[model samples]
Target: MLTSTFGAPLAQKSARAKEITKCIAVFMAKDMRPFSVVENEGFRLLINTLEPKYHIPSRQYFSQTEIPALYKQTKEKVIQTLRQANSIAITTDGWTSRATESFITITAHVITDEWEMLSFVLQTRPLYEAHTGVHIAEILRSAVAEWELERAACGIGVVTDNARNMDVAVREAGLAPHVKCFAHTLNLASQAGLSVPRVHRLLGRVRRVVAFFHRSTTAAAVLTSNQKAMELPQHKLIFDVVTRWNSSLDMLERYLKHQSAVAATLLSPYVRRNAREIDTLDHADINDAEDIVKLLKPMKMATTVLSDEKTPTVSLIVPLKHMIESSMAPNEEDSATVSAMKRAILDNLSNRYTDVYDWLLECTALDPRFRTLPHLEEDLRQDVFRRLREKAVQLSNKTNVTMEEADEGDGGEGTSGPTPAAEQPVNLTGTAEEAEVEQPPPNKKTALEDLLGGTFTEPAVAESQVYCIESEMAKYKNGKPISLKSCPLEWWKENAKIMYPLLSPLAKAYLSIPATSVPSERVFSTAGDIVNVQRSQLLADNVDMLIFLKKNM
Candidate 1:
């Protein structure tokens, strides 16, 4: 009767309704709500006060029965999603809690055959074993083995910070050369710039002023009163976090926003007792802070773009690195501190990111915006394209698609089925290629082809109206490049198999890596939030299940 009148079912006893309640339990876990809320006395009283007839399962039933079943089903789905990918990249990091408990998190990134990007939290379990390189490698191998991706056919890349421990661990795991987190590297370089004597002195005074207002109630009240007297917006000072310098940027920016109020607060007798001589930030000091913001703001935006989990970031690495270097140049009239900071940043960039562009050369080349590689020297530019074309041709030898098959328009030339239309058009603005380089020597082969054994048959180059991978690449290089505004993965969806069937897989592989282990670090932050003081007694197994379901769902 209720369903007929209201156009929605009201009965909670139906099978589908029960399933939904179980899903609600998982959602609560994802949001970090207390499980006992489902059946606590206060909760029951609140619900009874509103709708006494409505029903919900007891906390014991949901916690002990429904959640386990939900986790099992979700685990199977996560595994199935992983199985559909041809390659996977991994990032892992260790975190410590206030109680000194150690936890490790592992995250995976992959691009589906249809060119959809995905990232999932594979595991976030306690570390009972020692922190040796061997133990780290063992945990890494177990996670990879669970997804059944141990072979060269499922090539894996491991990304982490430049910490010596992680470096030792990657070598022990025997994966490819380590891919350092691009965002983390930028932070390190930014920190170097901020460490210059003049910049450091400027930020030091700002930090002291913020600390006074943050800690003393009298100081905070005086600032509030002063802002009101001036008819200014009410706001609190921001303090830079000691561990992360990015917070320092926020602190400096916020201090500038309310500089008038802060200066007025210093005049208030209530705050004067706590204020030090260093607390007197002058116009010269304020000018230095403004200069620092101009230098750091672009770096901040770059970090955000590279830290994204929903988009392909590896392709943006080379281009962003170049963009940052070109953006931080100090003008002749700039302050001495600003110029010194600029040189430190540039030096750090040269020393650290030289390794980055080399590793990501192909990814940059594949991105339509960077197809010509404007930043590289002429000789190195030619060599990058040469190796890329070689990899494309070798990948083509392993596929069954030919130009004629693709031309027939069956739509299964390189994949198992047809792709749905993309949400955005692939930009076809101008050719991505600069000029064609000589073909790779016939002796060349990809690491996967070498590991998995040679291709089944070697066809003679260009026979019987069949398409060759080299020819496809040559044709593609001449086609118009896309706008930088377009999504790189969407462009691949439109043109990967459609325009260059044999080379699409190689392109997807290059774009699958996350630019930083920031995703992995962010996973640790989630785990930290889940395991706070009140929930300290939660078992490791339960924590793992909750984190996995939360991320994978």
Candidate 2:
């Protein structure tokens, strides 16, 4: 009767109603909101006020229907996008939910033909079996098979954290060309330095001082008042997490910023009466904290840079290690304690990623920015170049077969399948609305120079490809590298086809491999949010759908 008076309400299957429901699912995935939010009185009220003719669905409708539908649709699109990639790299990691459910996340990194780096969260499957290497390998193989990427690109490049099981799993899975997460390695090295007895003791005392502010309201209030009185930024104390050495640096740095306020808070009469139980940092502790912060600042910066997913990082491993080594070197003015800390960090940092040294060196050499490989001796650089020549020959063999087939055509003179549309070179102006501009052309070789130094063009046959690759290598090496802040991928995008066709695809293969498993770790971070207390009852499959949508959609 009410519907008759107000006009028939929207059906659940109506376009308007289904659209709203899909949005609700998207809200849950994007904000990590619980599906039960639909059951909340205020939320229902808001919905009712917004659309009197529409009906809100139950949480079950979203969890069972809308989310799964969205997941399937999005996965299809991701798969199609993956097909367009010339090469890809894989990163995977494991996590345990609050409900004691174990999940493993897999992610793929690829560079678009236009050179835009894209990362896909492929899956976050719940693990029902043991966490043994063999079991893990099976799961990995299944993920690759499910994605239909078993033979895609230049073979799978797997990256995982520096865990024993991860190492065994990659080997067991036969996913060769694996890389240990460089960020994890840096953390281990940084922790080794922080574990020095002198630094460790100093940090503990400082931790207690920060804890006092957190525990005692009176102390915290006094610190705030002192900060205003002393004209310092209104910043709170930072409590360091044991696992993240960077957090320790953050705590010490924040404390140093408000050292005067903290000292005044400690001396406050209200604080002192309560301070008998608290241990405060002394002058020596303060000095040590300052020195340690100085030591760790570079490590913190390296972690920040390498953890970024927007840019290619595999090529950065060599250069960053060089920079870290230089920073960890002892100086004449160093205190005995600081000197010891330096030794500890260098000791742990040295010989890391040794298993992949040759691979890393190859990536470094191919990167135009670091082609000179200033960090290595001349002989080491020469050895890397030698490998590059061999790799060029191996790649040329593969290229020859494809070219021959293309020449033969599908039936007569044309290749099968529609030719792919050409991608517009990246906009130097950083906007499509702006007038189209030409990619600034590279320096041209003079006729005499071309004759003497060989033209930078594609080889006509397999036999000449090796000689052409050598000529391209010489030109690349002699050419001035772009600025340190410039993007190597962007440079290649602009010049790859015209200047170095043989090496361009090789760059695509190597540069797509990330230096860390941060992409997979990032998925688990989203998973943690999705599988929280309110949603603890969510089935593993549901959790996977939510996390996959949260990341991909």
Candidate 3:
């Protein structure tokens, strides 16, 4: 009877009731999980479920502005936590996007004396138009001050790559002595030292040949079938020069074992094309191939040498020097070949090994102040020479031993002597007048000398003055524990105010704590991680929030 009178209204009411039931069920499901554990997941799910209600008629429920307000509230809390840290270090680095807009990210972290890393803040901003040192410094200072750490003594270090602008900015900001990233330096040195251009070009040719064979399905199948005919199976292979060199050497040695199959494979139509290209290669290419083969031949010997568990008794330099001496020795027959090999080795060393030796010498000659504290200067020097001698020995051992053994053994057990100390030879041509340099006066006290003071004062000159003060102070031994009540506080304070006017700036400088660049470096690394390509769309406010959250959490 009720439905007959108000059936349309009842249907509308029933639909609304179902909607309410669904909302209640979703809310209850979300509430059952720990709030912190499921906040993000639950929020996303709720947003998806409420899609229709957002535009539904006769409903004015949730506000869109509330979500943003909640985010703001959380961000503020994060900022407060960062501000509470005692000290923070910062890092900053510049990044560019595909669109070519440059951005700078600054990161802050709190450090403890025990070297605990606590992430503090990370912020990204559009690199300012000027991008000058001053401008960069201002940006960094603003970011640090934002966290209320502008005056905090907790900023112990800054770390950065060797960029002049970034380094200058760090110094201008009064964050001195920044540590250049050691790992980056090592990588750069290794890349420069080990990347042989000739080797690279040879490897490139190998890659091209491999690509030609592998690109076509027919060529790959032919190569595979041929490999199988030779009692070998084709496998996925890379055109690594080192790997290929070893493989080629092994195959060449076993040529008699598989000569028929090898001949067939090489004469194949696909192989013919590769061989034709190889045959037409220039003399330089042939030399490169020979050189590569020769260089790699020593690898087997090198591996054998490395496998020996015992450290070689002889130093590296001695063996290498001995090898050079032996190779250069006069021979009745094969003299030309010996001479050519010796010259090639010498030329290679002069070009490649000179810099390494120079660097070692420079490192060894560094001031005693820079030497490792526990090791004495003599010990440090010995250690360096020992390493060099060992490497030399290994190189010398690589040469043919039988022919040169008699010649080398002539010098007896001590055949190869220690490398002579590298000296700065004086120019004998210079006049005596030119050699005589001016010297400072002996009485002129250096900063350190002044700080140390005289060994003993002349007693006659200042004795009376010291005795008068001591004698007067000795009378002040009242039974009441030297109470100030027995004497005027002003008189006592005035008498104690003796000034040391002779103190030097160096002495004053020593009183301050040693500053390091580690803090700046860490900040730069953190900044790089946060403002990377994947997160480029982050807005300024969100970036700030993320930085604050990272620093605190």
**Each candidate's TM vs. the true structure?**
0.81, 0.88, 0.38
lDDT of candidate 1 at residue 218, scale 0 to 100: 87
**Mind giving the per-residue lDDT tens digits that candidate 3 earns over 1-553?**
5345434332323666446434433332223221122235565566436542321212112112222333455557655655544334455666654435566766554422222334433566767486777878887767655545442111223445556787678878766324343323322322231235554554456455555555656555665687687676455334344422345434223332333443465468866765555322245654555544444354333333322212211112223333333444445653333334434444443332231343223222211121221233565544543332332222122211211332444653312221111011111112223322232223455676576545444344245433443343232221123321332222223333342111111111111111222333343444444445655554555444444433433
Off by over 4 Å in 3: 1-85, 112-115, 128-130, 151-156, 199-553
lDDT of 3: 0.39
Backbone clash tally (model 1):
3
- Model 1 lDDT tens row, 1-553: 6446445643787776576577668766778755666767876677555544446777767767777787888888877787677567888888876557788889888889778888888887678888777788888877876755443232467888878777778778766536888888898889998999988888888888888888889878888888898887888999887667688899998889888889888877777866756366777888888988988898899888887776678778778888888876768887887888889998888666454456587777877667777788878877776666666544443222322333444653432332121111111111224222233234446777576544443433434113466676666655577787788788889887767776677777677878899888886677776777756766777677778877877
What TM-score would you give candidate 2 relative to the actual structure?
A: 0.88
Best candidate per lDDT, number?
Answer: 2
How far off is residue 429 in model 1, in Å? 30
Q: What tens digits encode model 2's per-residue C-alpha lDDT throughout 1-553?
A: 7577667888998999988888888998889999899999998988877877878888888888888899999999998888777566899999899999888899998889898899999888877888888888988888777875543124578999888888889888767578888999999999999999998988888898898889888888899999999999888999999999999999999999999898888888888988876666778777888899998898899899998887889998988988898898889988877999999999998989787888888888778888888878888888777667666555555444434444555643533232211112211111223313233233365677567644334333545877888888778876787888998988999888899988787777788899998888887678778888888989888888888888888
Backbone clash count for every predicted candidate, in the order shown: 3, 0, 31
**Which regions in candidate 2 have their CA more than 4 angstroms from the true location?**
399-460
